[model samples]
Target: MAPDLPVRAHARRNREKLIATARAAFATADGTVSLEGIARQAGVGIGTLYRHFPTREALVEAVYGAELDDVTSSASALLDELPPAVALRAWMDRYAAFVSTKRGMLDTLRAGWASGRIATPTTRERITGAIATILTAGAREGSLRADVPPGDVTAMLVGVLLSAGTDGTSEQTGRLLDLVLDALMVRRGPGT
Candidate 1:
């Protein structure tokens, strides 16, 4: 059992290292990046990478899935640390970063989707669910308007991001996110 445990731990570490390395490579790569290069950067042999991810598409899918999971799951974590309105704003930043990262892998992702090699993810639903979670909490706390639908917020955010484009400056994106947050926030009258 002890010997098996070490091997499993080592394999887990290798797998995580490969994924992280691949994610960085994909995020910065101008075109198709070599899988061998990813393994070299991760300090693992090419065979190890193949053992963990049988194909390039598999690795891309895994990286995409990992990013999606992080962005979606961050909603609850942020809400725990900050006010709902603040958390929602922070989540928008995370989602924007996630979108930016996809730029490097867009070609491969599009090809995979067209070829049906990669399973289509329920991306919109998951994103909407995360927004709903934050909005529900904010509404309960009277910080956000309860009348606004989460799907509308998602649509508006997508529009803001699409309009900004991948080259959008942080200041511009920040201003847009602020506008969205302001729209969702409950306003108070002067002098209570």
Candidate 2:
């Protein structure tokens, strides 16, 4: 059946509300929170929530996917607005914040994985691709070292984010990111 144009806007609004509510609920609560509670918090009926997200895994994935999209999509815009290296640093900072938020979902994600509901590769690829985009721009601009592999940088960033999200403070995370950025920069031989 085709969608009713009149209801489409309403449906989108409800879906957004549900995703936002679920993100907040998952962050505050340990492990899986009730779908009914999420629907109630979203001010939508359980049927609506189920209609948008048939399973808990679906809801979790939607919330995480939206967050990933927001972070990754900024790369191009950042590159357009700032110098390559500066844009890359800003993008990495956003990525770190995204990881910090996602750290709250570790238990839920593991549970989903145990049940074979979430695929790990897709998430990894999406993030790596985003970082690659920024790194490629920096390489092309000669701001970052041409020989440094973007994938290697991505893997190291994963460690930084994991460490920061686990116990390190934001200030420490910023310092770690600065160190990574410094390492990525092309070294100048002699000043004119």
How much lDDT does candidate 1 score?
A: 0.94
Q: 158-177 in candidate 1: lDDT tens per residue?
A: 99999898778889988999
Candidate 2 is scored at a TM of 0.87
lDDT of 2 by residue, 1-192 (tens): 357875998999999999999888876765558999999999999999999999877888888888888887888889889988999899999988777777667776778888889765376677777778888888888898878777888888998988776679889999999999999998888882
Which candidate achieves the best TM-score against the true structure? 1
TM-score for each candidate, following the candidate numbering: 0.94, 0.87
Worst 10 residues of 2 by lDDT: 119-128
Which residue ranges in model 2 land beyond 4 Å of their true spot?
1-3, 27-34
- Count of backbone collisions in candidate 1: 0
Residue 47 in candidate 1 has what lDDT?
A: 97
What lDDT does each candidate get? 0.94, 0.85
What is the lDDT for 157 in model 1?
93
Q: Which residue pairs come into collision in candidate 2?
A: none
